[model samples]
Target: MSAHRSLSWLFTLGLLATLPVAFAGGIRGTGDLGLVIERTTGSVRILETSGNRFLARVEGLGDLSHASVVYSRDQRYAYVFGRDGGLTRVDMLEARVDRRVVQAGNSIGGAISQDGSLVAVSNYEPGGVRVFDAATLEPVADLPATFGDGRRSKVVGLVDAPGNRFVFSLWEAGEIRVADLSDRANIVVTRYEGIGVNPYDALVTPDGRYYIAGLFGEPGLAVLDLWHPGEGVRRILSDYGPGDEPLPVYKMPHLEGWAVAGGRAFVPAVGAHELLVVDLESWDPVARIPLQGQPVFAIARPDGRHVWVNFALPDNDRVQVIDTESLAVVSELEPGPGVLHMEFEPRGEEVWLSVRDENRVLVYDTDSLAVLTELEAATPSGIFFTARAHRTGL
Candidate 1:
């Protein structure tokens, strides 16, 4: 071959290699994508935040009245857990359900394993946790939350922990169980008794070091050090409840929205209009910032500069932002009625909220607190983003 001809052939191969990257540059990945659940219709709308537009609307999801979602490691698929025990695997790119199964009578929520190889659901009716293969949606193990003379307890606070393990709380049993699945063939579960009564929900720290369960039957929270599991569970904020007769709780606070900013944890006070701030170093209550109503979700920005909180009924229409450093309500907004949930952008530039009563989803600029966009939906609730796939607990 001629020297010039050989040089031209080499240049052609280099251009071909660059073509794929150039083409991909025009296509946005799933990182900028998210979904909003239409609770009334049992459907979800795939949203792309970069353009503030809806990509597709998928329907026929069962019983999303209290639905929650978790994403695969690649963020290409989402596992939706519904109230009617329906586990639906959704393909975000195709905007369709990849797989669906009714695994139990009733299920609260679910989590993906740390390694993203397994998905686990916590059931309320049958009272157990079921682990499934993430890729195939096939059952890998069945863990019944049985305790005290064959009574099955409802499982709550299901979270993926480090080391390919699952940690959950047993409602009726008043216990916490850590299921180790490091070896698929041999599953080991360590159980802790007396982990606080009626542990409704729980959260794990970002570092995957602590698992805390919020108690409904008591005033305090139950904390377990995953690093020191043999140390068992300890009680925190045991006397944080009200001194006088507490007001009626409109809705149970979601601990999944617990925020840790600047080494402090901001959590909702049960049955009270307050945001309890705790020193993460000591796991002790530092201060309680009074709120407008019972706080439902107290979430922090990614930068830890601020916390945005939504309240329960009668105050549900309002959202208050708290300055993490100042420890005060910085700003407030009334997006609409029935503000079910809030999700921040991956970098915390914007926040998306589901307004059920108005049948809309509102996006707001975090810095300016201005309405960026409004989307139409039936009755949206949980707003989940692909960013959660990288977080420890959602």
Candidate 2:
């Protein structure tokens, strides 16, 4: 098979949401664009591709420093999961906040369903998965963080499983959960033990065939078949790094900065100053992408050609762009300060970088690899982009 087709077919199988959504159909392609999910401003900014300039801003969010943007299957809605446990409903077309529900002390982050019918939130501190209505931005009734057992569970990763079903990770329990979002009124599911200690994130491949979870506490991995969610949830610990010393697991893995795409998972190994690229087929490490400093937040280009990574260390002032194919650091672009999260404008080549310490959003030219514009934010910590999510136009 050809290389690009090999990647595309792998995705035909995988993976949405809410609030009076009039948008239609799945995305054809993001076009020449990048989307920035701004946390501090509580706004998603639109940077036009004509240049790295703010074209328009999606408004009406509040103190969203720890939120994430996961688009609907059709790109009609953008689900904003906040660190403070605020779930905001946003209209992708109108570029406005439709509604929001706040969960106290909850840092909501996880995977959305492919059909955009359900959303799963991993409450790290409290240790549970909160199911929600994808469109109306409301909560769905389900088994409320309960197991017939006495042991309290700690959930870190909640994923969209097959046929609009849901699976969650119990970090403290070292187990995987299969729940029914399709029947949210009275959800029924089972839990199976896996290889790792604190499972941080889980994602289904584009083709909707396989699902994998990354372990944050131990050097372990879990792979499962989507159809038989209960079975095949096996944990593999073969490819663990050298000098693999056991760390304290008082709490679950602390958001080790992870994301998945193009049949690969990019997980930040802060202690090692490297990113683990896990292949889906064998469910193993195909390559280790190294960086100069401690990598924190990471993002992949829409084309799947490159991945942008940031280090939490003070010395790493710039974001390093890596060629995904070669697993090599291609270039480092400047936005300055301790850069953390990133968002791509919907209509441009620019990726918005959140320089928290600098309190600004730097728009860099993707082609020239130069800073084109910088929008000073009010205590800028996170950045996002929201625009008229055009179907035909984009």
Candidate 3:
């Protein structure tokens, strides 16, 4: 054989053999995640955040794919929710498809369960929430966030509570629904409505005795006693020398995400672009963590030294890291656009955020807020960390 032909053939053979074995560890087919690209109408990109470098790209899933995603408690798999309600499971380990299981009721942009067993999805267009099983991906249950008083109730957020109950936020009715998830068919629970017209989110305290409702409408906090369930839920920060005009169902001013630590709860107000620090013992707005943009999610590090907040819009390009003690914006890492949601690894060292508009996932060093690298997706929408989400032979 000629020398030039021999070298070319050898290189081609090596490339063929290396390609299959390189990503062989990542599982594919039924158990992997589906990177849904809504805008491109092409293949969806899969990101391997678990690895050092953001290795990527997958074909065939196409656009109009998954919307929201949920990771199993064991970190065994991830479920992607389509905009039109198509739900599929992605095996994280192998980084491939598992199979389709269920579809949602409407166009939901968010989904998460309290126990990580059942998925609660927010239906944007239809204005409701759908609940489903975490494993089987079947139509286990469905419900709305409406109140008996006849109002357009939209599901904003839903968190799993103890005693097989779910505390849901009603965007329009301005109430909180604690439904009995034990019986999916005929679930029943008491509804608590007070404080404001639209409670953006409801949070159960660690003691499980009382809960905090983010009064987005009026821009304050509401305290509900679990023992009473209703009994006229008390309005906290009612007279902190009020200044602004109070109204029914005012967003942006709404407080979302609950960080309960050091005998207090930290609520993020997206409208004011600040963290409404509330003391559980006193139930008052102690102080405000002035962030750069409208903050949506706030999660504390393991040492409690810092808490990271994701800005939703108007300033969706930054992830502000605040010092827990000073409660000041220590550093801001520019992670591109649409940095709405983020989650930490089990170690609390790695932060994974989805730049939905940019179609990329930015992984940052928790301490320095420095960009380690980024995982690019076709239209990378939702992301999650798998601490224990394992996978076998695909």
Candidate 4:
């Protein structure tokens, strides 16, 4: 071969050698990644989801008592919302914090815009929502939950809806508001007042058509037809509880824990040992399956066949599986003490759960209901996977 030809061949060989490095920066698939939040230590552990291997730990996050995470569309960055209002953008590939900001005094959770350009946080201290640039973590807009003689209310259940909108509920105001971010510089607010008494948490349907808020001070829930906003909000199941006598509430049921399966919704009844099955079509209560204890998180498996539920306080050590088709408890597993949270694999093959008291993360096969692997962690609370990037209203 001529010298020029030989040099060209050498360059081609070098390029092929570096191809693996390029792919390493991007997640190869959902099987290769996930995050475990250590609530007490204010840190996160990146893991290889398939093998249950610990990859890296990113720390120094502040007051993570009630933290949550959302990933960018590319699944390369994780936006973590902390209890102390700390929003830390973490680079999943490099296993480090790319950017960090303390936007408020206290924050509950957050959501990312449809186009992945904005990150919006729901706050409690100053009682407001703040939108920031997803790339830079810079302030984009500040929306305060002010009402009734200018008094602020704690904002909860903040979610990003289509058409550049961020929807949330005000706990004290008993209202729901939609902030249009089409013009991110100045948000146009649409308020739907008198939603219910003490709206604790809310969630948007998978199709982004309906937004429901669970009332803490009442037995029923408030629903809003997002596609038809002119109809306003209406109360559903207004008399769902045992009459007159107040029900005992161990912990406030989180709306985020509510699950949807096969055209129906399995919601944990507030302060009750039952899962209320609601028909998504008519918005009526269909059935209530009695559970072991007050449900904390009742999440549906990806295939919509089974729902795994964990309880609050004294019953947190156990997790039970419910069959969606028959509407009955199918299986039960003891996950040890402080079973804080659970997340299934993207396709529903396996699940990863955080057992805080045991200082371990347990991985179980969904079909067998058997523990496959366990990785040591410290006070782990939430388990998030990059696969959430492709889902709506995550």
For this target, which candidate reaches the highest TM-score against the unseen true structure? 1
Q: In order, what lDDT does every prediction score?
A: 0.90, 0.61, 0.59, 0.87
lDDT by residue for model 4 (9-92), tens: 888777545443223444355335778999999999988876678877889888899999999999888899999999999887
Give the per-residue lDDT digits (tens) of candidate 2, residues 254-333. 23222555777676662566677877666767777777766666666656667788776554477888877788999986
Q: Pick by lDDT: which candidate is best?
A: 1
- Best first by TM-score, ranked: 1, 4, 2, 3
Locate the minimum summed-lDDT window of 10 residues in model 3. Answer: 385-394
Query: Candidate 4 — which pairs collide?
Result: none
Clashes of each: 0, 34, 23, 0
Whole-model lDDT for model 3 versus the true structure?
Answer: 0.59
For each of the candidates, the C-alpha root-mean-square deviation to the true structure, in angstroms, is 6.0, 11.6, 6.6, 4.3
TM-score of every prediction relative to native:
0.93, 0.74, 0.74, 0.92
lDDT of 3 by residue, 30-141 (tens): 2223233433553344544446444344333323443545567655566665666555666554445566643444554444454566766665446666677777766666
Pitting candidate 1 against candidate 4, the one with the higher lDDT is: 1
Worst 10 residues of 4 by lDDT: 18-27
Specify the poorest-scoring 10-residue window by lDDT in model 1: 19-28
Model 1 lDDT tens row, 87-143: 999988767788998999999999999999999999998999999999999999999
